[model samples]
Target: MSTLFGLLRKKMLAPSLASVGFAERGFPVTPSAATVKLEAVPQAVVCGFEWAIEGASLWELERRLELVEPEQRGFAYEGATMGYTILDAMPGGGRNRTRELLEGPGKPHIFLTYIGIGFAMARLPRPLWKNILPELSGVPYHPTMSWLAVDGYGFDRAYFDTRRWVDEQLEPEPYPWAGHPGYFSRAFDQGVGRALWFIHGGDPRAVAEAAGRFPERRRPDLWSGIGLAATFAGGCDRAGLAELRQASGPHHDELALGVVFAVKARTFSSFVPRHTMTAAGILAGLTVEAARALADRTEVAPDFDAPEPPYEVWRDRIRADFSAGDQRRAG
Candidate 1:
């Protein structure tokens, strides 16, 4: 038995004899290699049940078991969640600001929840709330001007499409499973986006319904565009998309579209920053932004009524700015 289990067993079998029993035996309460293996047994398929191996290697299975062990002992536990968490931490604004904002209250107050700011809002639990007042109020008042700061431009639309694929069609399999990317995708579609619409401006219930609507055909394209954006930019905003064009330069309208798509899919508060310059950095960047923007606008079905004409109009102005940038780049 493992040290913990041995101690537990002693407690269960003879509550008062635990200390004395170990002392008399002169045995340290440490878990032996055998005990570790014994404790590592897969509980879900153990005891009297038939143990059959499917496609998983014993090593992989063991690694998975180690993850849930609570001592930071499993690759599965770290690999899956850590990757998603890292991805989640990338988006509009700086990763630092995005993180501070998502983890706290933020400005534009789009993704962050500030009681008195850009839009109406409410307070959050102490543990959940992330205060951005200090960051926003800092010297030069240099609030993150571009969404590209978070490096969300690096994300590809396929990331989300893969999630959509597994979700809509997946045969049941034994062993534990996770949809980390799916969760990130949904967080944008359901959590962050919904939070932005209702918490920032619309009715919560209606916003919830609206956010749930997504096009089947566009899922793949949309995911691909987002993945591309994560590659170059941090976050997506009307202004940031325009900057992406400037920063990317020449024949790169697709990048512009990709960035736009990522923004529409989810607001970018938790974006990471990307600094590498690809060979066709300028063209690729511009192309991504344009593609993403087009994807976002086109994917939205025509029948929905406009709730915030002023906001939508403002957004259109931003889109037009990008159009001008595209024309300039083309010229």
Candidate 2:
């Protein structure tokens, strides 16, 4: 964010008049084996990031992300597979292709939450609207919901946050994932509940290009409100270390270490997605060990031979391991 914008954001986030909480909670953790059964499909709104390239369409962008067939990119793990989904309604065949990848015989989709086009036009500085309007004449967008404050990367946290918050507000009881009586409290208190996955090895410009700009107003504030509330509700932290270790054994150790390093390197919060750089022993795998392992080795060390899809190689492994039956209960 630009200095002017950052200051404005900070001013807005500061505790005062209507005090929307934006706590310093780290990233939330994906539940363990025992917790999976209890894990409800969160009433989430899938907010995807997109960029409107001059010549490129969302279709092409989605393909590059899927990295499917003959694309042969180094350090292949499932980053693209994790975040964002393409809407099935899109023209041409991209939607069908995405559906086949998601619902087809491939790995059971777990991480992805929604389908959206990154507002490719969002990257422009808001102040430049006057001069840029002529070039943006043909763009199609819902005026009321067109732009969302997604930070510099075009990632609008407000949509996701709003989804989660709305659920919490309207639900009669706490969410099913709330776990034990005080579980949510402790989780938020300690910062173990908020998390974001960081994908590796994508062109930066591609990402930026994909994350076009949107109107900036209450989006960031709204997202910050949800984020801060989650923090107070039991956000992510090192507290789960002992439990995570006891449940997963040596593998958990590696994951915990990696999580630690990730937090240290990226001090803002573990949820922040840095460029995909590998650090040893940090990429622990419960089910997708082969894929995670290969990813860690290649992304970190960068060695010979183009690797196969980690999900393809370890599909069975992830199915067997990370499944709901074997999940570990943090309590």
- How accurate locally, in lDDT, is each candidate? 0.28, 0.23
Instruction: Summarize candidate 2's per-residue lDDT along 1-331 as a digit string, tens digits.
Output: 1245334533442223112111111222233431221121111111112111111233543445344321111001122221212222222313343333333321221122111212211223333322221111222111111111111112222223423422232111222111222222222211111212111011122111111121222222222222221121122223332332343232333233233322222221122222212221222222223434433332321121224222112222322343332366432
Query: What is candidate 1's lDDT per residue for 114-187, written digit by digit as tens?
Result: 11111100111222213322233432112222121111111111112224322232211221111122222321
Model 1 lDDT-worst window of ten: 45-54
Clashes of each: 70, 38
lDDT of 1 at 75: 16
Query: TM-score of predicted model 2?
Result: 0.23
Model 2 CA lDDT for position 316 = 24
**TM-score, each model?**
0.25, 0.23
Off by over 4 Å in 1: 1-229, 232-254, 257-280, 283-318, 328-331
* lDDT score, candidate 1, position 24: 30
In candidate 2, where is summed lDDT lowest over 10 consecutive residues? Answer: 38-47
Error of 1 at 39 (Å): 29
Give the Å shift of residue 221 in candidate 1.
7.4
